[model samples]
Each structure stands twice: as structure tokens, then as C-alpha cells.
Target: MRLSRYFLPVTKETPADAQIVSHKLMLRAGLVRQTAAGIYAWLPLGLRVLKKIEQIVREEQDKAGAVELLMPTIQSADLWRQSGRYDAYGPEMLRLVDRHEREMLYGPTNEEMITTIFRDATKSYRDLPRTLYHIQWKFRDEVRPRFGVMRGREFLMKDAYSFDLDEEGLKQSYEAMFVAYLRTFARLGLQAVPVRAPTGPIGGDLSHEFHILAETGESQLFYDAAIDDVTREELLAADASTIARLTRLYAMEAEEHEKVAECPVPAERLRSRRGIEVGHIFAFGTKYSASMGFSIQTADGGQVHPQMGSYGIGVSRLMGAIIEASHDDNGIVWPDSVAPFQVGLINMRADDAACSAAADNIYKQLETAGVETLYDDRDERGGAKFATMDVIGLPWQLVIGPKGLEKGVVELKRRASGEREELSLETALARLTAR
Candidate 1:
């Protein structure tokens, strides 16, 4: 992907309406454009980042034993009616009347429809523990949608539903998602703490929202600082002897917080911090299943309403949250795991024969070697090109200028660290290949 051939419409001026750093940078970078008050049309760059985040969410969900299947964004209101929340749901529910005068809606969540699926397919406890998920768009008519994707009216989300015959079975499904959230955030380079949170519209007795700490975050979180230090591998590798160890760790939302000395985390490890809710899991025993008759027959000839749980991760909002957690003054510093491109190759003087040739060769070599890179072969000044490259935040950057090309060297600068070193062409290639 050459800069000259790319559709990135970066601007130097920040929009006056953007109130936060993440929102401002996203607009300046032209990653997204406002389609309405709280809706956006994701530009090429934003869409790429969205896909990368979506893939990571999907992989980690699969690893946690959840299967994937897509559900439609638009759902019939009849489903919600059966759940007894169709008209009771607030204005956030975008209710509408179709051409046939049938009540319908853009689904804000999928609990009702999922129940219909379960009730039709499974008749016995044999399929007791089933978890299915989908990555799709959702709509909520936010009265005052603001903060870019953080509180958008329309967005992408990964929602998974779990159905189990008994409380014992439901616990297993909940634990799977609990651990999955940890791994998903860790893999994306986020230190997310799972705090007990309100289920809101998705009623439940047990719920936890995985919050990623960021200064510009919307949620007020109080957490055990130790949660940040624990890694996904540690939690996933824990044996049955201490399987619930991670859950026992202290963490909670402002609402569920208890100012008691019994909190297991040490005083030093307790920090009241602000964070964005990226993922949430809930165990709503029989809420959706009982409402819609999604029951399985027990061996004793009794009907049992399957307990249910729903897990959600804001797939699109995560892109903005990642930028918020990781960016500096320059621009978006994308984490390598979800970076749209791993490296950027800039021809400092695209018109110069030597610089152009070297950069072209390096770009081709990197691509041939299976490296995702952006070749900035544009008719722009060196400073402008460098600034743009820094803001785009590729992990590694290769700069070939006429001056450096004459010495058979190019400037290799890493984005994470503003460290630049002149390296011979062979050495630069080697470092990039090793990455």
C-alpha cells in the first residue's frame, strides 16, 4: 500500500466538535466521517482497523469454545414483544412499522431471537451447554450520542449467547467467556480489568464488564491494580485446583463497590481508575429462555428452562479505545497485533532517482517477504511525509533519502520509540524480516 495510492485523507487541523483526543485524532486522520448525529461511515483506514479488531475478537472467542454464526441487524419486533420488552423498552430501542404495518426494529441486542433459535432446535439436555456468537452491527437511538464511536447510535459488536440446562452448566459457560475476555484484551495489548457491572437492559444476576484504562475513557472504574499485571496465559493455564482464582481477584464498577477491608487485593494494588467498557459478560438465569419457552427435558421427565448468558464486546468502539489507550501527541500508535500495516517505507525524495529506486525496492522486498507495509512514494516534503507516517503509527518505518542512499544506508526508525538508526540496506532488510 503506497501512500500516493492510498485513500487516507489526513488533515492537520482538528475538528472543533471533537471533545476528546481519540475523537479528534480519528477525525483528523480521516479514518471515519460523520453520517449523522451519532452515526459514522467508516473510511478505508477505519474499516481496516475495524476488521483487524473483529478478527482478533473472533479468534479469542473461538479459543474460548464459542462458535460463530451471524444474526441480522434488523429483527422483527414480535420477538421482543414475546420477551415482554417490546413496548416497555425505552426510546433507545429504534422501533418502527414496516410497509406491511408490522412492528419491527433494528435490534439493539439479540436475546429474544436467540431464544427462538434454541427452543426450536434443542429438546433435551444433551445439548445443554451451547454458546453461539455473532459479529454484527447494532442500533440504539441514543438521545445524546457523543464521543465518536465511544457512544455511537450505530456500531459493530460481537454478542454471544450461552444456553445451559442447569446452574452448574451455566457456570462453565460463564467461566469460558470470563477467561476469554482476559485473553482477548491481552492479545490486543490492553490491560483490561473485569469489574462487576450493571447488566443494564440485558438483565442478569452476575455480570462483569471488561474495562480498558484510558484517561479519556467514559466509565468510572475502581479496580485492583493487580488485575493489570495478570496475563492471559496465567489465567488460561490455571488448573482446576485454582480455577476460580482469577474470579476471586478484587475488581468492581463504581456501583457495586464495597468499602470493606476484606477486599483481597493489597492496599498498594488498589487504585480507583477510569476505564472504557470494551467487553461485558452476563449470566441471566432463565431470563430469555423462560420468556420464550426455550426449555430442555430432564432425564427425570421434567421440563427445565435453560439458564442463559450473553457476552458482548464493542467491536467498532474498540478501535477508538485502542487508539485512546496507546496514542501519543503525534497520532494513533496502533499496537502491532492489530496494526493495519506493520511497517511504513518512505521515499524521502520521491522525485530523486536514487531515493525512489531504493524505496521501491525495499517496498517490493518487504511485500515479497510477507510484510504488510505502506510505501510513501508521494511528491511531498520529507517533514510532511515523516509526520504522516508517525501519525499513522506503523510499528517500523524505513526512510530512504538521497543522502542516506548515497552511503548505502537508510534511516530505520521505530514508531513506539522515537529511535532512528542509519542501517545498511541489507541490515534494514534483516531487521524488518526478523520482526
Candidate 2:
């Protein structure tokens, strides 16, 4: 992508309505624009980041034996009626009427719809233990939708549904998703702590919300400090015992937290911090299946309601969460795994032919090497180009200038740390494409 042809509408002044750092930075960086209250049009740069996060979530879901299928944003209100939640789900449900005067809604969640799908498709225990997922947009009528995408009324979500024959099977399926969530967050360069959470409308006895610590987060969390060292690989291979070992540690959100007297961990081990919720998992047993009359034939030819679980990761909200956890004073310091572009190629002297030729050559080399590079070929001052690159926060920045080209060198700077090194053009290309 070349900045000269890009549609980035970066601004020098922050929007007064943006109360959080992620909201302000997202606006200033030209990632997204608000079309309505809590509704946004994801600009090109923002769309790239959203897609990257979606793909990572998809890959992790696949690794956990979940199959992918997309679902529609709009659903029949009868689905909720059958599940006895049509009246129970409050104003957050965006209710409406179609041309035929039939009750309809933009789905806030898909539990009832998925349960209906499973019931109609499967008839016996042989089809048990199936996990299905979709990445799609969802709408909720938030009374006060603020904090940019973090609490947007319209957002992208990765929601997975698991069907099993019994409680034991449900536990196994739930563990798989729990571990997958840990690996997913780890790969995205986040330290997500799984805290025991109350399943409000989901109506599940067992639930956990994965939170990333940030100073400006909305949720106050109490957790054990040891959760910081848990690795993705370890979680991937974890068994029931291992999963229990990790979950046994004290962790809860502020609403559920009682007191230090009730905490299992000692004062030294317990840590309190503000965190943003990015993912949630639930084991709802037969809540939906029983309510919707979804039953499968057992080995003994008896009808039994299939146990159920749902796992959700806020695909769009993660952009804000990542920024909240990772950015500095300059701008967003995107983690390489989820950055919109891996490298930002800057033509520091865009007006100079020698610098332009060198930058063009390096850009071509990077393209040939299968690198995602954004070339800043705009006719702008060197300082302006640098500032824009910093605001966007690519993992690596390749600085090409007349001075560096004349000396047979290019400057490579790491965005996370303000560290720069002058290396030969060949060496710089080699290092950038080494991964």
C-alpha cells in the first residue's frame, strides 16, 4: 500500500468525544470514522487490522477442532421466542418488524439460532461433540455506547457453539475453547487472565471472562500474579488437571469479588488491576437445548438434551483493547502478529530522485519477498512522513534518505523501542524478510 494513493484521513487534533486513549489514537491515526453513535465505518487501515485479528481467531478456533461457518446478522424473533428469551432479553435486543409485520431482530448473540440448527441437523449421539464457529457482525442497543470500538453498539465477533451429549463431554469441549482462548490472546501479544465470571443472560453455571490488564480499562479485576507467566504452548497441551490447576488460582471481576478474607490467595500473591474484557467462554449445560427442545437419541434409544457451551471473542473490540494495552505517548505500538503492515517504508526525501529510486527498489524487493509493506511515497516533509509512520505504528520502519543512500546504508528502526541501526541496503532487506 502506498500512502500517496491511500485514503488515510489523519488529524492533528483529537476528537473531544473520545474519552479513552484507544478512541483518541484511533481517530488521530485515521483507522476509523464514526458514522453514527457507536457505529463506525472502518477505513482501509482499520479494515486491515480487523481482518488480521479475525484470521488469527479463525486459525486458533480451527486448531481446537472447531469448524467455521458464517451466520447472518439478522434473525427471526421466533428463534428467541422458542428459547423463552424473547421477553427476557431486555432493551439491548434490537427488535424490529419486517414488511409482513413479523417480529425480527438483529441478533445480539446466536445461542438460540445455533441450537435450532443443531437440533434440525443431528438426531443421535454420533453427531455429538461438534463445535461450530462464525465471525460476523453483531448489534446491541447499548444505552450509552462510548469508548470507540471498545463498547460499540455494532461490532464484529467470533462466536463458537459446542454441542455435546452430556456434562462430561461438555467439560471437555469447554476446556478446548478455554485453552484456545489463551493461545489466541498470547499470539496477539496480550496477557489475558481468565477470571471466573457470572453468566448473566447466557444463563450458564460455569463461565470465565478473559481480561487484558490496562490502566484505563473499565473492569476492576483481582487475580493471581502467576497468570502472567502462563505460555500458549503449555495451554495448548493442557489436560483437565492442568486446566483446573490454572483456574483454581484466585481470579474474579469486581462485581463478583467479595473481599480479601474470601480470596484463596494470600495478600502477597493477589493483585488488583483494571482490565478490558476481550473474550468469554461458557458451559451452559442444557440451557438452550432443553429450552429449544433440541434432543439427541442416546445409545439406549432414550431422548436426551444435548449439553451446550458458547465461546466468544470480541473481534472488533480487540483493536481497542490491544491499543489500550500496547500504545505509548506517540501512538499505537502494534504487535507484529496483528499489525496492519509489517513494515513501513519511508522515502524521507521523496523529491530527491536517488532516494526515490532506492526506496522503490527496496519496496519491490519486499513485495517479491512476500512482505506486507506500506510505502510512504507522498511528497511531504521528512518529519511529516516520520510522524505519520509513528502514528500508524508498524513493527519496523525502513528509512531511506539521500544521506543514507549515498553512504550505502539504510536506517532500520523498531517501533516498540525507539532503537535504530544503520545497515547496508542488502543487510536491511535480509533482516526485514528474515521472518
Cα RMSDs, all models: 1.8, 1.2
lDDT of 2 by residue, 1-435 (tens): 788999999887889999999999999999999999999999999999999999999999999999998889999999999988989999999999999999999999999988888789999999988999999999999999999999999999999999999999999999999878878888888878888988989998999999989999899999888876667667656556657877987789877776668888888888899999999999999899998888889999999999999999999999999999999888999999999999999998888988898899899999999999999999999888888989988999999999988898899999999899999998999999996
Candidate lDDT scores, in order, read: 0.85, 0.92
Q: What is the TM-score of each candidate against the true structure?
A: 0.96, 0.98
Give candidate 1's total backbone clashes: 0
Highest lDDT against the true fold, candidate? 2
For candidate 2, which ten residues in a row score worst on lDDT? Answer: 233-242
**How high is the lDDT of residue 141 in model 1?**
98
Quote model 1's TM-score.
Answer: 0.96
**Which residue pairs collide, candidate 2?**
none
Deviation from native of the Cα of residue 370 in model 1, angstroms: 1.3
Worst 10 residues of 1 by lDDT: 235-244
